[model samples]
Target: MLDGQASDLRVFALGTDRAGGMATAAQILGGAGTGPGEFQRPTALSVGRDGLVGVFESTGRVHLFGRSREGELEHRTTFQFRMDIEDGCILGHHLVVTGLHSEHSGVVHLFSTAGEWVRSFGRFYDTDNPWVSETIERSLVTCLEGSDEILVAPLFLPEARKYDVLGNLLWWTEFDGLRPIYLAETADGMVGVGTPEDGYHGTIGVTGDVDGGIAILQVGFITRERRESGSDPEISTYVLAADTGEGALLGRDFGRIRDIDGKGAVLSRGVPFPTLRVITWPPSVRQP
Candidate 1:
């Protein structure tokens, strides 16, 4: 989970039983401070296949931790930067971090897993082309395991871009009026949730009212199909679901989706008292 509270800086791991049932809290990593293992505002969390957890703090510090035999977090190493980090992710032994210097400029910094600097790219606000300017606001970065491909979606732009390990632009696609908020890789390909720039304008379910509801968004999937012979890859798009001003389902209000699993996704819903809702994919159709 993302640790935003400066008073209680930690990366918590919720436990699960052998039968996939909810268990006790497994472990907690880091504390509040500016030390090697402490945090000042851990904003992003990513777990690597090697069982290491990378925590990116708003203080421009990155900490790496591993699980001990007793299920406790053991601090490994840490790195620091100058800019305020917006988001980050781990790709194998590489760490990619996006930082914002001013209102219009940002950069993506790459580093080795051992806390050594690699290379940096993308300048802020200079949108000359795809390579030079990144314009990452609320940066969202995701790495496709074993593919050496990374996906980045900046809030200010309407497109989600793909880049290689060397920071080369691969391809990008527009999401129409939707602004991508979260991205994840699935068995089929990649799935993302985009909230409508303006509130929902379509028909309100059953009520026939035009007043836009609190929740209305789109979920899209992108599948890459390889060619039989030597040719460019073919990509297919699917609109899994797009809410048209539906109020709530199963007594739960709708919010942004956090993570997607095989059969469904985990949605962060409600306010004042935030709660989680595990919803199956291709949600049931709302009656008009």
Candidate 2:
């Protein structure tokens, strides 16, 4: 699962092994199409509070669909662009898309739910500051629940950043070895998982029947930041370790986690054979 949303009657799954197909609680919607409601290389999916589903295809298009009375996908509209979209999320009546250009610069574009382009800001590069250059190429965008802020994770930088709705950078922290690929926020704090840049591997028991098994160094952590009056936020980081029985859970390629009810998380291990697992926190240490 890439991203999923649940309505009163059905659940929606995107980027499964089905290839450009959107799966419902009972059936699949569209798959690998250039025609209406079809997708080619669907990269991200998000559902709004009103049951509207937004699917982002790698070919620079977004298809919006609604659930039918019979619990099926009903094609609504398509948002088209020229740049390659890396990831997207639905924020209320707005859609947020992030991607890179031929010039090796990153961008974040906002659009209306109706597919109207809003405004874009990014490609933050300052030749005078090498630190600023490292923060330019953002690869993921997700909304902070119940807040007007959005979090973005860079492709190569070991930092996750927060920005206001208008694209002003409010706060950021450097997580030395983690190269985050996904982000989710909850009432307690924000949780993220990513590949460890440093050669750090944890010993988890083997699964299936592979000899010597594989050591997975994927990192998951919960971070809490406190912003005081007229001061920068104080950041606290806790690195999480995988349980023994977890067993190569994070070794899968292109893995992501999403929060659930502030207690557990839904982990989606991507590609080849995709799998979804629901994991609880504390002892599990994998809270979305």
Candidate 3:
């Protein structure tokens, strides 16, 4: 996960145990700087073929890292773009970036590890108003495992689109009344779903995620009312069924789901220096 401290910004690899727990690995990558090997406020992380690591910053710069002969990650090069990057993933020799751009043609930007722009595609929501378009178009992107397909999930919308590495559209699926806050690639090459916030539209009235599926950890509208009355919203967790998209009560108070795999999920739970938790999925919730 990307730690956004202005003083000690760095990326640490997370390792999981057999009991479904996680912690930072010994190897630390990147540092705070504007130089070739350092980055500031990194927003996304992607690992591609050939031991390539791309650290994307909020300022539209991607810092590339590769393993040295001694098997340690070393900064290789850096590249820049004019748009604000939201999220990205690495596929083979290319880096796929998604963010807000002046051009509304597509939200996805394809680039080489050498920092060359290859192409851009995938439609973004546009209402003719720049501010609204930008806010609504924010999305999280992930490259599928064992394939060249990438999945894009809008932050405030309940839909996902699949695309090939060449920027060709494959399939688009929409979930009624469910906005995706995150997306992950399964070990079997399928897409795993996550949660969302109704803070923008206030339709779903919730936020956060955990485990194998989407989870609603708080009620927004009710929470807003309670806060007005000087009370905290009662925290609870609601898990969405993978097969039917139906939600059931889980437990309480977890952070946003960063990624999910065959073992389980990684959750980001604090501010500035967030703590990540990995929890194994219950057998019933694990998608086959």
TM-scores, all models, native as reference:
0.60, 0.59, 0.66
lDDT of 3 by residue, 1-288 (tens): 455664222445444343434454556666678877677768887776466877888789888888889877777888878889988888877788888765534778888777778888876664555555556667777765456667676656655566788887766655443323444555665545444343222122222222233423232223345445654334334445432335555654454555666567666554444566767788876755
Q: Which is superior by TM-score, 1 or 3?
A: 3
Q: What is the lDDT of residue 111 in candidate 3?
A: 82
- Minimum summed lDDT over a 10-residue window in model 3 is located at 199-208
Off by over 4 Å in 3: 6-25, 102-104, 126-129, 178-254, 271-273, 279-288
Q: What residue pairs clash in candidate 3, if any at all? A: 181-195
* Per-residue lDDT value at 42 in model 1: 81
Clashes of each: 2, 0, 1
User: Whole-model lDDT for model 1 versus the true structure?
Assistant: 0.52
TM-score of candidate 1 relative to the true fold = 0.60
Best TM-score among the predictions, by candidate number: 3
**Candidate 3 structure lDDT:** 0.61
The C-alpha RMSD in Å for every predicted model, in order, reads 15.4, 15.0, 9.8
How much is the lDDT of residue 144 in candidate 2?
48
